[model samples]
Target: MTPRWYEEGEEPDYRFTLANERTFLAWLRTALALLAGAVALAQLVPAFSVAGVRTGLAVLLAVTGTVLAAFSYRRWAQVQRAMRHGRPLPMTWLPFVVGVVAALAGVAVVVVVLLHTR
Candidate 1:
C-alpha cells in the first residue's frame, strides 16, 4: 500500500489543515461555477453567424473547469505536504494558466462577434 502523507511527516496544526481544505473546496466551487456558466452560455446565447464559435467557447470553458478541478487537488496535496514537513508552501502556476484561459475565451468571443457582424 502507498504510504499515507500523515505517516511520513509530522502533523501540522489543525487550523492550517482546515484552511487548506477550505481552499480546495473553494476551487471545487469555482469549477462548478465555470461548468454552469458554460452550459448557460451554450444554451441561452442565440446562434451566431459564425459556425462553431459558441461551441468552441463552451468547450474551452469546460476544459478549463476540468483542468482547475484536477490541478486543485494536486495543489492542495502539495500544500498539505509542505505544512506537514515544515517547508514553505510551493508557488502555484494554475492561477496564471486559468487567467490565460479566461483571456483566450474573451478574445474568442470578441472575434466571433466581429466576424458575425462583418
Candidate 2:
C-alpha cells in the first residue's frame, strides 16, 4: 500500500523524484559499505591489545549502518514531500552525525593500529 504521505503531496517533477531516489540509493550504498566494514573488522581483523575494542568498533559501525539505512527512506520521503509542496528542503543532521561518527571510527582505528604495532 502506498504511504498516506505519498498521496498527500502533489506530484513532483519526474527529474526531482528520480534525483531523490538516487540520493536515497547513495545513502543505501554507504550503509552497505559500513555494514561490510563492520563484518570485515569483526571477522578478518586481529584482536586489539585492549580487549573488546575491536568488537566495540564493529558494533558501532553496524549500528550506524543500520540506523542510516533505516532513516534514508524517511529522509527521501521528506524531501519528496517538500518538493511536492513547493517548500524548501528540510535541513538534516544525518550527514553531520555520520561524519562525526565516521571520523571517530577512523581515529579509533588509527589508535588501535598504533597501539597494536607497539
Candidate 3:
C-alpha cells in the first residue's frame, strides 16, 4: 500500500478550507487598509499638533497592521494544521496586542493635540 500525501492526517472539507482562505484574505485586506491609512495620515493630513505626531501615529498603526497580518498568517496555518491533525486550535494574543497598541496611539494623539493647543 502506498502512503498518501495526507498520510499523517485526513483532508478536511473543502468548504472549511475555502472559508479559511477567505478569512486570510480578509485579514490581508485589513492590513493593506491600515498601511494605506498610515501613508495617507503621514503624508496628507495637516499637522494638527507638533511635527512628527502624524508620522508617529502612522508608524504605530503600520506596526499594528503588520503584526496583525503576521499573526493572521500564523493563526491560519495553525488552524489548518490542527484541522488536518484533528488537534485543538491554539490560543492567540493578537486582539489584545492590537487593542493595546491602538490605545497607546490614541493616548499619544491626545497628548500631541494637547501639546499643540498649549
lDDT score, residue 67, model 1? 88
* Residue pairs with clashing backbones, model 2: none
The candidate maximizing lDDT is 2
Worst 10 residues of 2 by lDDT: 1-10
TM-scores for all candidates: the values are: 0.85, 0.93, 0.78
* Reference-based TM-score, model 2: 0.93
Tens-digit lDDT track for model 3 on 1-118?
5334335588888898788789778878887787888888888989875777788889988987888888898778777777788888778787688778778878988898788779
Per-model CA lDDT versus the true structure:
0.88, 0.92, 0.80
Clashing pairs in 1: none
- Residue-by-residue lDDT tens digits, candidate 2, 1-88: 7878887768988999999999999999999999999999999999889899899999999999999999999999899999988899
Q: How many backbone clashes does candidate 1 have?
A: 0
What value does the lDDT take at residue 56 in candidate 2? 92
In lDDT terms, how accurate is model 1?
0.88
Of models 1 and 2, which has the larger lDDT?
A: 2
lDDT of 1 by residue, 4-52 (tens): 8867689899999999999999999988888887898799988778788
